[model samples]
Target: MARALLPLALVGAFLLVAPPFLDLGWQNALINILIASLFALAFNLLAGQAGLLSFGHAAYFGVGAFAALHLMARIEDGLGFPTPLLPLAGAAAGLLIGLVAGFFATMRSGVYFALVTLAIAELFHSLAPHWQGVFGGEAGLSSMRMPWGGLIFGSLIEVYYLTLAWVALSILLLWGLTRTPFGRLALALRDNEQRVRFLGYNAHVTKVIIFAISAMFSGVAGALQAISNETANYVLFASGVSAQVVLYTFVGGATIFFGPAVGAVIFTLFAYLVSDLTRSWLLYQGLIFVLVMLYAPNGLGGLIHQHLRHRGQLDWPRLARPYAQATLGSLLVASAAIFLIETLAVVFSRDYAVARRDAGGGFPTYEVFGLDWTPLSPVPWLLPLALFTAGLWLVLQARHPIGALWQRVRAGSEPGVNPS
Candidate 1:
């Protein structure tokens, strides 16, 4: 776990400096990663550590997000707390709701438990759209920055740092929770509920506690998401969101401490990359998930850990060369593909036809750099298409040698083989 913490701490430090170097696109990507990672960690507390699988954890998350959004919107209207610390109130609401729900749901374990949670999620999903006063109906709730120590989060980058702070605090607390005696007891409860009861431990209360803690973290995540996006809707409570959270945690390697975080980064980057390339981006996400599930049960992070353990000693410096090469190749291919696809869309757009028919049409003219064109020429589009294909080939070819070298190095043929 300490080994895991080192990498995470370094990553957090890097994030502190990342905003200045990145544009809005990358900052948005990081925000997605942070939100997903927090959500996964919350789910893991229930499913991975406590042996309680929830199909509707999004109930807490959605409620929390809505709670924060409502608070932000109503702060001026004099109904809720200030926006900066809104997550605490949101978490409190989730905790209270989780406790009530857990008491009723934990009466029966296994499939019954999952069903009860799912029903609760469905109930909330139905209510959000109808309860216009609280949920904002179809339009949802939109929020603006409230006064907070003279720091207004008007910029997307500002929201990213705020989310980063929330993520760090939430993860730290969850990590510490896992090290406590109560956490150990929860593990025991997971292992054998009957045995735990026989030993005089109240298994129901243990589960309820775990459920509440999980809900609390989920609420924090939701609140951060609400702040980042400034929008809360009924869709957040949908079954799809719950399913995505489950998939994210499971595919990331739930058993390991930091696996979910690694999974979040990979999943977010893949989504952004795919959505930029093809209209049917979901198909690509499904395919990647299926492949990861089949080949890497422990997830990408787990695979790395397993490989390091096999070497008897883990060293960050050793991974730099191969990781850098692989990462560089991936970025190059992804960028080229996105550039080609977006350029082609403009070059052959129906908007171009409309524009040509009426030069002063209501439709905005397409432009890039300083050139406003009625439509892009085929010649300009072809250059990028050709380059994209070449980049794809180069990246694929580059990875082969890197992989071979890493395998040989990992197999003990390399020097500095610290057989510690």
Candidate 2:
């Protein structure tokens, strides 16, 4: 715990102090990071801890957003609701819907449970557009954040702080839950539900509670989003929203407690930085998920934990070299992929077609990676192919040394081992 303090304090300081210096676009992105991190963490509760993978978590998230919108509208109508506490509306709606949904969904485990959750979210997505009164129809809902206390609640920075406070508190609570007896039981459920049932614990009830808790927190995350944006559409209930959270959790390594948030922050920031530069940002994100799944199946958090666990036994410079090789290989592969994707996107674009037609039906030159390359040219095909081959070979080569290094550390056989 003592060792954890310094890092946590520095992180907290960065989060608190850095936003004021950022431009509006970055401030908005930071707010998004907070919300996405919270959403991933909440999903991790059910998926990671309880072994219940909810594909329709967007259901609760949408509910929370709409609920918060309704509250904001009320506050707009001169009600005395505190702006800071508006997320409770989301929390309440999420818990209520979660209990109702969990009752039926938890009856079945595995794919059936996932399908049921998917069905529930689809149900919401279907109904939200037509049910204008509650969901505000196709227009969704919109409201203004009212002033509370001396705070104006008018600026992005103000909203960022509000979101930060709520997210920090919610995460702290979720972490605390893992220390409770119920937390251990959640692990049991994840490992073997049959044994938990054999112990006479009400597995169904336990699942419902866990699901509700996950949804409630998910709702809070959604509320923060609504608060920041001041509007939401039925798109919140879309399957894409649900899928994104799943990606964040597994890609971040759901086995580690804070891994999903780690994934969330990285992906959110990635999207922020890269989305402006390329239309294939989603493709890049998917490629990243695939690569992580293939090589680092334990996820980033697992890798971090592995290093920390063996920190005292390892040689930093020696270990760092293999890690660097792996990083270099991954970057090369990613660059090759980006090059291929961008080239394809340009080649298949309508403007490219128009240009080709104007040029008498010939393949045209396209700009990519700050250089122009002709379609049907051998260079474009050869470049990524060579990159892919070299990157794969480099990665494969690094794995042997990396594995051996870790093996020696595990065996306490490495020379110059530091007892500290």
Candidate 3:
């Protein structure tokens, strides 16, 4: 606990103080990060806690958004409610909808359950556009955040603080949930529903409660999002939104409490920083997810957790060299892939094709990262191949040392074990 406090304080201080210093775009990105982090954690409650994989969690998120917007609309019409409490509408709506949805969805487990959730989200997406009265048609719902208590939320800074407070509170509440008896039951359900049922718990009801609670928080995230954007749309219910949360949770390490938040922050920042640099940003993001899933099956958080768990027994001095080698090797491979992908992206672009046509159908010189290269030339293409080869060799060389180091660590940690 003492070891955790310093880092947590630093992070909290940074979050509270950094927004004002950041540029408008960065401040806005920070807001999105906060919202995404909450969404990821909320989704993790269902996925990691109860071992329930929901593909339509976005339904609750979208419902929450629309609900908040509706409240805001009413407030605009002189409803006298405090602006900051608007997300409660979203929370209530999400809980109600989640209960109804979970009642039916939890009847089946595994893939069937996932499909039902997906179908529910799809239903929302399909119906939202046509249900103009509530959803405001295809344009969706829009609302203005009214002034309250001498604080106007017109600036990004105000919105950032609002989001930060809500997210921090929500995360703290979720973390507290893990310390309760019900939290242990959720884990038990995750491990074996039949065993939990044998232990005299209603498995279906347990699942439904977990689902609704997860959805409630998800709605809070959505409400925060609506607050930031001042609007809600059918797009909020799209499968992509649901899929993104899954990717965030699993890629961040679902087993770890804060894993999803880590993934959300990294991916959101990646998008904010990299998306403008290339049209292939989504491809890069997908590739990253694939690589993380393949190499660190438990997610990046799992790697950190493993190191921390074995810190006392592990010989860091012996591990450092191989770890450094692995790091460099991975970087080399990633750089090579980036080079190849970017080069190919530029070469295959419509502008490049037009240039080829104008040049009498010959492969012409194209710029990638400000350097011009002709596709006919082998020199530029050799760089990625060289990088890839070196990277593969280095990673292979490090593998043996890494394995040996871990083996020694494992052996050393055993009771009464002696190491020479």
TM-score of each: 0.74, 0.96, 0.98
Off by over 4 Å in 1: 1-5, 78-82, 313-420
lDDT of 2 by residue, 142-236 (tens): 99999999999999899999999999999999999999999999999999999999999999999999999999999999999999999999999
TM-score of model 2 vs. true structure: 0.96
Top model number, TM-score: 3
RMSD in angstroms, candidate 2? 2.5
In model 2, the clashing pairs are 132-137
For candidate 3, lDDT tens digit of each residue in 1-420?
877577779989999988899999999999999999999999999999899999999999999999999999999999999988888888999999999999999999999999999999999999999998989989999999999999888998998998898999999999999989999999999999989999999999999999999999999999999999999889999999999999899889999998898899889999999999999999998998999998898998888888888888787888899889988998999999999999999888899999999999999899888998989999779999999999988999999999987888777878898754
What Cα-based lDDT does every candidate model obtain?
0.79, 0.92, 0.93
Clashing pairs in 3: 132-137
Which should have the higher TM-score, number 2 or number 3?
3
For candidate 1, write residues 1-420 as lDDT tens digits: 798568768887898987769989989988989989998998899988899999999999988888888778777677546556878866987898889888888887899999999999999999989999988987789987676666777888778878888888999999898999988887888888889899998888899989999998899898888888888899999998998887787778888777777777777888888676556466556755776788678887788777756554444466566567556755665655555555556645786667656866444457543565433345446655666666666667656665665565565645777433
**Residue 252 Cα positional deviation in candidate 1, in Å, after optimal superposition:** 0.7
How well does candidate 1 score on lDDT at residue 287?
56
Give me candidate 3's TM-score against the actual structure. 0.98
Which regions in candidate 3 have their CA more than 4 angstroms from the true location?
Answer: 414-420
C-alpha RMSD by candidate, in order: 7.1, 2.5, 1.2
